[model samples]
Target: MNLLINVFLLSVFFPYITVIKSLDTQPTALFLGTVLFLIYFKAEKKQNRYIFYILILSILSIFLFEKSNIMMSIRGILNYWSLGIISYVSYELFKRNKIKNSIIKRSINAWFILGFIQTFYSKYFFKFLIVGMRTSDDRGVTSFATEPTFYGIICIFFGILVIENFKKNDCILFFSNLLIQILFFSKSSMVVLFLLIWISLYILKNISLKAILFSSTSLVSFHFIIINFLKDTRVYKLYIKSSDLKKLFFEDHSLNMRLSHIFYSLKGALQNFLLPNGLTQWIEYVRIETLQKTYFHTLTPTTSARIMSGFGGIIYESGLIGIIFIGIIFFCLKKGLKNKEIAIFIIIISFSAIQPSFPLNGFILGMSIFNLEKRRIHKNEKIKSNDCCRN
Candidate 1:
C-alpha cells in the first residue's frame, strides 16, 4: 500500500527533474533527492529476484567494455535506477496484492478531474496547476504528466488497473480518459487508439485463427490503400501539417539520421562489443564532442551527424550485449507470457519506437507488463488449485 501510494502520488508528482545544460548534449535527469526519504528505507518484498539480476547484468556491462566518459555512463545507470528500479519495485508490490476498489475509484476520479482540466489546455494552464495535477503544454495536454506521451502511458496504465478491478464506474472513467486523450492530439494518441481497440476486442471471446489472420491482413491492406488514396488526393497535406505528424501520417525524415546513430553505435560496439556506451544519446553526442575538442585546432571535423531514434539508441548505448541482456529478461518471462503478450509488446514498442530516448521508459513499461502477466498467472493458479480441491 505504501509502495502503491509512493508510485501513484510521490514518484509521479515529484519527479523533480534536474536539467544539465551542455552543448554536447543536455542530460535531463529525474531524481527525487528528498521527497520519498521517509519511505526510502522500507524494503519492498520481491517474489522473484529478476530485477536484481538485471541490475547486476547492467553493472557488468561497464567492466566488459570500454567505459568512455564513465561519469556520464554512471548517470545513464542512475537513470535506469530512477525510472526502471522504481517502476519494477512498485509493480512487485502490486503483483501479489489486491488493489483496493476504493483506491482504484479515487485514482480514476482524480484522472477524470485532471482530464477535464486538460480540455482548457495551454502553456498558461500548464504553468499553474489548477489542481494538484498538471494541465497543458505547448506540445499538447500533459495533465499531471510532464509530457503528452508520458500522460497517455499513465492513462493506459490506469485503464488497465480499472479493468482489472472490474468496476463499472471505473470502466466509464477509462473510456472518458480515452476521449480526453483524443482531445489532446498527442503523439501518444496512437497508443491510446490501439489499446482502446484491442481491449474492446476482449468482448469477442475465442477468435478463430483464420478470422484473426484475415482481420489483420485486411487492416494492413486497408491502411496502405488509404495512405495511397490520401497521397492521390493530398487530403493528408491539409490535415496533418506538422513535420513530425507528417512522419506518422505520410513521410519521415531521411533514414540517414537513424542510420548514422545505429552505424556509429554498432562501430562503438565493435570496439568493445561485449558492452557498449551506456544508453544515453548524450553519450553519443558527448563522444563526438570530445573528438571535436581534440581536433579543434585542425580545420577538420571529427564526427558524423547523428539523430536520435529509439532502436538506434539501444544499439548505441547497450550494444549487442545489452540487447541480449534485455532479451534474456523477456525470454525468462515466458513462464507467464499470456495470449495477448504479442499485442501488449506491439503497443508498448509502437509508442517507444517513434521517440528520441525510450530505453528508460521502455524498461519501466516492459516491467509493468511483466508484473501484470505474473499476477494474472498467479490468479489463474489460485483458481485452478481451488477447483481441484473442491472436486
Candidate 2:
C-alpha cells in the first residue's frame, strides 16, 4: 500500500502521461485518504498529536476565512491537512518491517526508470505520441505542468537518488539517471544535479579531484548535447527558450514584479495580521490583481509566484499570524536537518519554494523530518544504553 502511494505521488509529476493533466492529485489522494480512514478506525491508538494539530489548523483556517467559496475553502483545508496525513502515514510505514533499505532502493530505481522514459519521450518521441500538445512557456511538456521547472524538480529528486546510489557503488543506476537528466535539459535539474553531487561527496567526506572533474565533465557534456545538438528540435525549442531563461534569472522586470507582489502581500499581511480575507477573496484581490497588472495576459492568477509571493498569499488569506505559524514549521524543519533525514527534508522544502502544490511538498517535508528525528533518537538511545558494555 505504501509503495503504491509513493509510486502514484511520483507519477503525478511524470511528463508523458496525458491523464495526469486532469487528475494529477486524485490517485494519490484516494490512496492516502483510504489509508487515513483505515488508520483512524482500526488502530489501537489514535494518530500522533501533530496530525491533530494539522487538522485543527485546516479547520480553523477555513472558519477564520469564512467568506471563501466552498471550493476555495475545501482546497485550502485539504492543502494543509493533506501534509499532516501524508507525514503521519509515511512515518507509520517507515516504522514497519516492510520498508527495509532494499524496498527503498527498489522504489528509487522505479522512479528513475520512469523518469528516464519520460525524458526520452519529451526529448524525442513526444510529438509522435501526442499530437497537438503544446509545450508550456518554461519548456515543460504539455501533458503535465506548463513550466519545465516542475518536471525539472522531479528530475532533481530522481537525480539525488541516483547520486546516493552511485556513492554506494551502484554505477549503472547513477549513469542511467545522469543520461536522463541530460536529456531533459532542464536548468533547475542541472542546478540540482550539481548540488546533489556536491552534497553526496561532502556528506561522504570523499571530495576528491576525480569527483570534481567528473561533475564538471558531466555538466559540460550535457550543455553540448542540449545546446549544440538538440537546438533545432521542436521540444527543444519549446522547452528550452533562451528568452525565458534570461528573464527568469537576469531580467530586472521579473525581479521587480516579484518584489512588488511580495511587498503588497506583506502590506496586506500587516494590516490583517491576525485574521485575513477568505481564500476566494484573497485569490481575487492578491493573485488576480497582481498578475493582471504585472504578468499581464500571459500569466494565470492561480499559478504560483515567487517565494515571497506565496508568503504574501498566505498572509492575504490567513494573515500575518498564519504566515508566522507556517514559517515556524519551516524553521523547525530546517533545524532538524542536522539529523540524517536532511536529504529528504531539504528536497521537500526546496520543492515547496519552487512549486505551489502545497501539502505534497509539506507532507514530504514533515515525513522526512519525523523519520530523521526517529533515527536520531534511536541511535542516541542505543549509545546511551550500551555505553558501559561496549568495551
Query: Using TM-score as the measure, which candidate wins?
Result: 2
lDDT of 1 by residue, 1-391 (tens): 4554445433332231213322111222223311332243245444345555554654464453336555655655553344344445344435535335565556555645654565444433443432333333323455555555555655555555544445577577665665455334332433444553554454344467765775676456534543553342222332344446534333422222333444455556666654565544444454554464331221112333232344444455666766665564455443333434433443334323333222224334434455556776789999999999999
* Model 1 local distance difference test score: 0.45
In order, the Cα lDDT scores of the candidates are 0.45, 0.48
**Candidate 1 TM-score, true structure as reference:** 0.57
Q: Give per-model CA RMSD.
A: 8.4, 6.3
lDDT of 2: 0.48
Going through the candidates in the order shown, the clash numbers are: 0, 1
